[model samples]
Target: MTDTSKKEQLYELIRANPFVSQQDLAVELRLSRSAVAGHIASLIRERRLLGRAYVLPDKRPVLCIGAANLDRKLRTLETLQMGTSNPAYAEEVHGGVARNIAENLARLGLPAALLTAVGDDPAGSALQSRAESAGIDTRGSLRLNDTYSGTYTAVLDERGEMVLALADMALYDKMTPEFLASRAPQRSSAAMVVADLNLPQDTVATLLQDARRDAVALVIVAVSQPKMARLPQDLHGLRLLVLNRGELETRVGRKLAGDAELAAGCREVQAQGAQDIIITCGGEGVYHTSYTLAGEAGLTWLPAPKVDVVDVTGAGDAFAAGVCWSIYQGNNDLTLACRRGLKVAAMTLESPDTVSPLLAADILEEISEFHPLHLPQD
Candidate 1:
C-alpha cells in the first residue's frame, strides 16, 4: 500500500480504540513497530490524531455551518395597513436557518456544533450566549469586529401568517470558501455536515467538493427562493436537500402546479446528483424521495397533521432536525424520517417560539405514539 493509505489505516485503528497500544496497531496492520510509530507520527503531523495518547479529533457531532441571526417577530393586532404604522406585539429571539436547525438537533440530544459568522456587537454576543444556552457548541463560530450581527424581522398577520419579512443577512457574505477551508479539521471529523444556502455560491460549492472527496454525508437546507442559486447545479455529494415549494420552483425555474409536477421537479433535481430531495408544501405536507441501498426512486407524500397554528416560524428547521436525527440513527428508511419531520413540524407549528421550547430528546417518541403520520390510501 502507499504510505498515505497505510497511515490512514493506522489512524483509523487508533480512532477505533484510543487506548490501543502501538504493539497492537503494529500487529493489526502486519507492520513493524517502527513503521507503526512512523504512521502515528504522520497522523499527528496532519492533526488527525492529537497528543501522545493517540487522541483523535471528535467525530460524533453534526456540524452546522451558515447564518446565525437575531430574529424579531411583530404580530399585528388589527387588519392590514399600507402606509401607516400598525400596532403590534413584538418578540425577539435568536434565529437563523443553520442556528435554528442546530438548536433543534441539540434539543433532540445530538451533539451539535455551529460555525457561523457573528459580530462583536452585543447582539452577536447575545446570539452566541443563547445558542450556548441551547446546548450548541459555538467555539468554532466566527466573531468579526465592528460588524452588526445578522438580523431578521418578520411581520405576521393576526392569523400568524407572515405578511412581510425583512432580513439583514449581509454578514453572511463573509462565509466564503476560504473560511470553510480553515475549519477543515472540524468539518472533516463531523458525523454529518448541514449547511444553509445563506453561504455564498462558491462556498457551497467548495463544501460540496469536500463532501464528495471525503465521502461525508452532507445535507443542504435552502434558505430562500433567491438564495437557491447558491447551491451548485451539480449536487453530486449531497445526502439530502430540503426546500419548500417556492424554493423548488425557484431552483427548477418553473411553477410546480401539483403533486405530479412537484415529484417531477424533485426527480429532476435528484438526477442532477442529489441522493435525496424533500420539498415541503406548507400546510399541505412534505414530499420526499431517497436513494437507498435498494435503490428506491419513487417520491412519497407525508400529509401534515392538523394543528392549531400559533406561529409558523422555524417549523421547517424543526423538520430538518427531525429528519437529521432519524438519519443519525443509521436508519436508511427516509419514509420514517419524513414522519418524524412532520411530527416535529407539527410541534413547531403549535408554538410561537422560533424553536419550540417543548422539544426534548424523547419528545418525538411521546408524540409519535399518539399521532402516527400516514398517507391516505387511494
Candidate 2:
C-alpha cells in the first residue's frame, strides 16, 4: 500500500483499539518500529487522532481576565403565586463568570491563570486559597486594601433554578485598561484568553484587541441578563461565543423559535464576525456555527445526556472552558468538543456551589476520548 494508505489504516486501527502498540503497527504495516513511532508522533502533533494511551497538557496555557465575586445563594421552592413576592430560602457561594471559567479551565488540567481584582480581606483570602489549591495561578489576581471584595446574592427555587440575583462588583470595576495593559507582556505566551461582560466595555475591548494583536485565540462568554446587551455588539472575530438560547435569539435579532431557527441564528452571528458561535439549550444540547473556507457552516448539535439535576450555576462557563481546551489541544471534532464541554458543565452542576470538583487530567481524559477524524488512520 502507499504511505498515505498505510497511515489511514493506522489511524483506523488506533481508533478501534486505542491502546494498540506501535510494535503491532510495525508488524501489520511491514514498516520498522521506529518508522511507526515517528508516524504516530507526527499524527499526534497534527491532532488527527488522539487516545488516552498518550495525552499531555501543559502543552498550551489559557489566560482568563474578568470579574471575580463572592456569591451568596438561597434555596427556596415557593412558586410565585399570582400576587406574591416571597422566596423560601437562600444560600451563598463564591462565583463570578471570569472566575467560573478560570476554575473550569483549571479543572480541565490546562495551564490556566486568573487576572482580576479582589479585596484584601478574609473573603478575598478565601478566594485566593481556594483557587491556589486547584492548581491555578492566582499571582496575577489583585488584592485591593480597605475595600470589600465583590459579592453576589442569588435565590433558587425547589427546582434549583435561579429566581433573582443582586451583585456588588465595585472592586472588580477597578480592573481598568491600565491594569490589564501593564500585565499584558507577562502573559504573551497564552494559548487562549477568556473574558466576559462583567468588566467594563473598554476593558473588554482593550483585552480583545490585545489578544488579537498578540495572535492569541479569544473566547467570550456572555454573562448576566438582558440589560447587559453590550456583549453581542462587541463581536469582532472572537474565536468563539457561548450564550444561552434566549440570549442568542435576542442578540442576533432573530426569532429562533425552534432548533432549525437556532441553527440559522448561530450562522447569522458567525456572519457578524464571531469565528464560532454556540447556542446552549439547557438540558437539551448546544447549537453551534463555525466559519470555513467555503462559507459559514452549520454546526452539529451535541446532546447532553440526561442526569440528576443539581445546580446549574457554572454550567455555561464549564462548557466554554471545555470547548476552549479542545481548541487549544488541536481537536476540531465539533461533536466530541461539545461532549467535552457538556461533561465539564455536568460536573459543575452536580454540585450546589460553583466550585469545580474535577481535576485537570480528568478533563484531558475526556478530551482524549474521541479523536478528530482529520488524523491519519492507525
CA lDDT, every prediction? 0.85, 0.71
Q: Report RMSD (Å) for each prediction in the order shown.
A: 7.2, 12.7
For candidate 1, the TM-score is: 0.82
User: By how many angstroms RMSD does model 1 differ from the true structure?
Assistant: 7.2
Candidate 2 lDDT (Cα, whole model)? 0.71
Candidate 1's error at 116, in angstroms?
0.2
- Global Cα lDDT for candidate 1: 0.85
Worst 10 residues of 1 by lDDT: 369-378
Misplaced by over 4 Å in model 2 are 1-60, 77-90, 232-234, 290-296, 358-360, 363-378
Candidate with best lDDT: 1
